[model samples]
Target: MRLPKTAHTSRPWRIHEIAGDFQVEDVWALPTPGGPDDLAHLVDQFAQGKGEPIDSPVARALFAIRWKLGALFGWDKPDGGVGGRLTSLRGRLPADLREGPKGPDLTAAPFTSVFQTHDEWAAEMGNRTVHGVMHIGWVPDGAGGYRGQMAVLVKPNGRLGALYMLGIKPFRYLGVYPALIREIGSEWRARAGQRAAGSAGAAGAGG
Candidate 1:
């Protein structure tokens, strides 16, 4: 579900340290609820591309259209991406965070991991339109369990980038994000079911 920007800003996330100049474009409550240690599993799912909602036809079509547009316009040229037109956020990391696990290389997205901690993981990507950060945190649900929260932060390139973000806002809210939430929930449930089945089989073997 879409959340207020405070849902991300209010937290003590390490992302705040490095991405202060970027604006918070969106915040979402992810559906992957679990115990404290489960953030790693959630991050793994993302890195493996198992939880991306782009598999949904609508989301896939939208992404394909976006990529085609980018290709035609030179928006995604290598020179426009991170480490080219934009400096990587990794360069801004503090000493401790820089030395920590940089998380896994994502198979689904162009984002490169910046840092990872027990409860937070951050990755970044850039193009002609913007330099963006995807920050995920495991937060207490107030009901004892913990769930994932995602925040998107961006520094737009200029007028073109601002207009592009404005143009896509409707489609993102109406189609992409909803499908993303549903897919993540479905994948999380499937993983839970597999774990349960494995435990049951182990119990049966012991019996």
Candidate 2:
């Protein structure tokens, strides 16, 4: 579900310290409720690319079109990415964060891990249009369980970048995000079922 910017800003997230100059583009409440310690599992799912909405045809098509456009326009050239166009957020990490788990490399997305902790994970990606961070946090759901929260922060390249973000805002909100929410919810439930089945099998064997 779409959340107010405060949902992200109100938290004392490390991303606030790292990406202070970036704009908060979107905040979302992910439907992946579980135990407090489940954040690691959630992060692992993302690392494996299972957290993405790849099964959604609409999302798949949009992604294909965007990549095609990017390729045609030289928007995704290596020089326009992380270590070239923009300095990596990894360089700004404090010593503790630098030494901590940096999460796993994402095979599904072009993002690179910045840092990871017990409850938070951050990754960064950049292109000609923007330098962006994907910040994921495990937060209390108010119903006694924990769920995931995501915030996207971006630093646009300039006038052209700003225009590009503006142009895609509608599609992101209307088409992409809804598909993502559904896919995440479905994946979360499937994982829960698998865990439950595993527990049952263990109990049966012990009996």
Candidate 3:
């Protein structure tokens, strides 16, 4: 999460947000053709900072155990294409991103082609060109089709960042990402609620 002392060009989509004790600064240079102007709204929304990506109890619980399943066993890799891809990215992946959602999807693939360091991630994406979002649900939607991949910017506290699609592939979204997102978000939210309740209970008992 620590950034290198060497200064690199700040991304146009940079955002600053504080989550608990963790201060987050994220940047993504997506290959979309819309250019920097394309992200004005995203930056504004994230800056306003309403949604707590990690605040929900569901996400917290899911995120807590996710590393175990997704990282160690790699069962989280939908089609099993990415189980071993991570080992090859050792020096290539910066610590901030060394651990993340790994998968066969373009967004989570072993941090290889996209980048190794934060600077590289930003530099590589600068002015890059790629086939734009093309279609929403490319594979098909909930039934055999993907739930459409949408480009979103993510910033984990402490400079971890990326502008990538929340890719929901055929059955991947409905069968996979959607389920996981809800499951994790739900679990995380519940845990946070429990923590709040515990604190309140302790206060009442003391009173």
The TM-score between candidate 3 and the true structure equals 0.23
Q: What is the C-alpha RMSD of each candidate to the true structure, in Å?
A: 3.2, 2.9, 17.7
lDDT sort, best first:
1, 2, 3
Clashing pairs counted in every model: 0, 0, 20
Compared with the true structure, the alpha-carbon lDDT of candidate 3 equals 0.28
Output the better candidate (1/3) by TM-score: 1
TM agreement with the true structure for every prediction: 0.92, 0.91, 0.23
Give the C-alpha lDDT of model 2.
0.88
Question: How many residue pairs of model 3 clash at the backbone?
Answer: 20
| Each prediction's whole-model lDDT (CA) | 0.90, 0.88, 0.28
- What is the per-residue lDDT of model 1 for residues 76-195, given as tens digits with 9 covering 90 to 100? 999999989999999999999999999987887898999999999999999999999999999998899999999999999999999999999998998798998888888888789765
Candidate 1 runs further than 4 Å off? 50-52, 193-207
Query: Among all windows of ten consecutive residues in candidate 1, which has the lowest summed lDDT?
Result: 48-57
Q: Which parts of model 2 have CA positions greater than 4 angstroms off?
A: 50-52, 193-207
Query: Model 3 segments beyond 4 Å from truth?
Result: 1-86, 93-168, 197-207
